[model samples]
Every structure is written in structure tokens, then in C-alpha cells.
Target: EIEAVAASNRVEVKPIVMCRVTQVYETGACVYVYYGVNFFGVDDPLQLFFSIEQACVEVMLRHGAALSHHHGIGKHRKKWLPHVISTPSLRMIQGIKHAIDPTNVFATNNIIDT
Candidate 1:
């Protein structure tokens, strides 16, 4: 069992790095790392890494656990069909992308303006 240390009135928390392995990678415009420390359903047999931006976004939106252990929203996993470009924040993002790219080279879905 782990012992607790006390302060004025609250117990001081000590961080424990409960991990086995970690690796890092870098690509065109991004760098990513994989931590092999995990629990059930996270069948990470190999410690791997990817530096692709698309891959990073893909994993986060798809496999990586979210607020309530939900799936993805991209072409791979979640595959959500966004009919409407809802919200002012999203509109702002579209506007910004259009302002920068304007040619729609990195165009995918949802953000049609880009």
C-alpha cells in the first residue's frame, strides 16, 4: 500500500510515472510520441510513434479515448457526416483557413471554404 503525506489541511500528492516505455517521432510539420503505459482494451504490444499530422489527428479523433470513451469522427473510425458547418467558432476556423490557403489544397470535408 502507498502511504499519504499531509500538509496544512490537504494531503500532498506525489506524481508516479506508471509507465513502461515511451518513444518519439518527427515528420513534415509535426512530432508525436507513444507511451506504452496503459490499461485494459489498450492492447499496445509494440511501442510505436508517428510524425504525420494527418495520422496524429486521425488517432486522436478515432482510437484515442475521449471524454466518455467515444470513437472517432474522421474517414477511418467515427466517419461522422457533417451536414452543416455549425457554430461561430467553426466559421471562424473556416474563414482563417480560407484566408491562409485560399487554394483549397488541404481541403477535405466540413471546412469547404478551405
Candidate 2:
């Protein structure tokens, strides 16, 4: 995936199969994990603010595969929902929800914020 990005794909186009690593495998099975850490430093807090938010949301999304088959659609990734998910996929699956309810009044547990 990183290689594809370096090749100037603009957006991450790889279809990733992610699973949190809780147990080690004894056979030839492969474990695909997005190992991440929330790093905070006292330096340049103003800049760190956005970076921290982005990283935090990403971690949460990665933790909950129920939100997305590959990764949870955290708020930070919402903006790119269009990119990661195909337009047709979005329209076919999500368009109705947003159209009939722009206020997102039906959203119960999902993150819906300004």
C-alpha cells in the first residue's frame, strides 16, 4: 500500500485486509496489522492538536472493524470516505441515509459531529 502511494496513486487504492493482532500464529498464516501509537509532545501544541486528533480517530477506526470491513470510518476518515469507498458504493449504501436524514438523527452510536 505504501509502495502504491509512493508511485503517485494520489489516494490509497489498495484493498487491505486488516485484523488486530491479539494472538500469534503457529502456521504460515499472515497477520496484517496497522500498528499505531498515540504520540503527544509538548512541542508546538497548536500543530500537534490536529495531528493528535487525526491519529486518535484512526486508532479507534482500526480497532472497530464492525464500522468498516477493512477499518472503522472514524471522523478523520469521513472526509476521505469518498476516496476509500467507490462513489457507487457510497451512493448505493450511504446515500439514502443521508438524503432522507441530513440531520443524522438516526445515527445512534456512530460519531456524528461538527
Best by lDDT: 2
Candidate 1 off by > 4 Å: 1-86
lDDT (Cα, tens digit) per residue for candidate 2, span 11-112 = 223323345644445642333445222223234544444554455445545754222444566564566465455678877666567667778887532434
**lDDT, each prediction:** 0.36, 0.46
**Model 2: clashing residue pairs?**
none
* Candidate 2 residue 38 C-alpha distance from true site, Å: 8.1
What RMSD, rounded to one decimal, does every model reach? 14.7, 10.6
Model 1, range 70-109, lDDT digits (tens) per residue?
2323433222223222467656876887888777677455
TM-score of 1: 0.27
Model 2 score (lDDT): 0.46
**Total clashing pairs for each candidate:** 1, 0
Cα displacement (Å) at residue 30, model 1? 19
Q: In model 1, state the lDDT of residue 7.
A: 19
